[model samples]
Target: YAASKGAAQGLAAGIQAGKGVAIKSLEKLGVKYFWTGMSSEILKMNHYKEVANLTDVIYTAKLKVCDELTYDNFVNMCEQFDIKIGVYTEEVKNALLPKYAVPNALNRIVSEAETTAKEVFEAESTRIAAEITEQQTAVINATYSSWQIAITASVIAIVVIVLIMVIIYLILRYRRKKKMKKKLQYIKLLEE
Candidate 1:
């Protein structure tokens, strides 16, 4: 009975090791399959096509898992060896679906990019227009100020010229009256 129990324990350990290897292999295969499918789908999209095509050669060279065994292959192998493995359910599907669903994610990203670009363009255009208007206003104000200064200078010049002319006329009148007074005194002296 002790020998039989030891054999059962050994068999159980062997089965566990086999399951571990199978699970590891399946995980690698699943990752490769997911990436390959994603790459193919991305290459079909307009925006991602160029980038995906650039990396397509690299992906094909690196992701060489086409001959790897899948779950079905593992099951078939188990059948050939006459081993039975039971299936179990987990709550990972819902979590993984939302995380790996690329279509909706890509659509949201593109929509956000387009909206952001439009807003940036509008803001830049408005900024440029405002700058131009401000510059034009400055130029108009400068011209008006220059015209006012010129008009003021011209009025000042005219006033100065008139004052100079009036002073010269008064000086000439005073000199002529003094000369006439001297001539009249001389004439009176001659008559006396």
Candidate 2:
């Protein structure tokens, strides 16, 4: 009987440890899955096709088993410990039943995870949106600046061309007037 009890204890301990590990694993997977989903949404919104595709792989593999795993672990541990302690009272059953307690604990864990994920997603989304907007604004400003420079240079070139034409016209008009004066003098001298 003592050996049997020792074996039972060992088995219970192993089961508890295994369940604990599973619960932790499930919790991590659930959180990571939630975060990946949020990040994927953001990536899609930002048009990051390649990166979003990569995240999709993780999304497919990540499992959301937090509730089921936690519930099972809670019930099994409660039963095992109650058995070990030889507590089979109606009061314990009524108070610490799986149906009553698992839901509450599960709800708390789910709620906490959701709240934290939402806060993180909101903050990250806002930051990324602002960054993209800033980058777009910078690109637009650069394009506008280049256009302005080109227009200014074109206007300057046009003005310089117009001034050169005006200068050439003035030089041609002055030479023609001097040539006419010489012709008039020669005619007056010949007439005299």
Question: Each candidate's lDDT (Cα)?
Answer: 0.46, 0.48
Candidate 2 backbone collisions, by pair: none
Q: Per-residue lDDT for 1-192 in model 1, tens only?
A: 333444444444433333333233323324333244443433344442132132333233223443354568654442322111111113222322322332333333344434443454455555555666677789999999999999999999999999999999999999999999999999999999
lDDT of 2 at 180: 96
* Sliding window of 10 residues with minimal summed lDDT for model 1: 80-89
Best by lDDT: 2
Over 113-155, each residue of candidate 2 has an lDDT whose tens digit, in order, gives 4444445445555555566667778999999999999999999
Query: How many collisions per candidate?
Result: 0, 0
**Residue 132 in candidate 1 has what lDDT?**
64
* Segments in model 1 whose C-alpha atoms lie over 4 Å from true places: 1-91, 94-101, 183-192
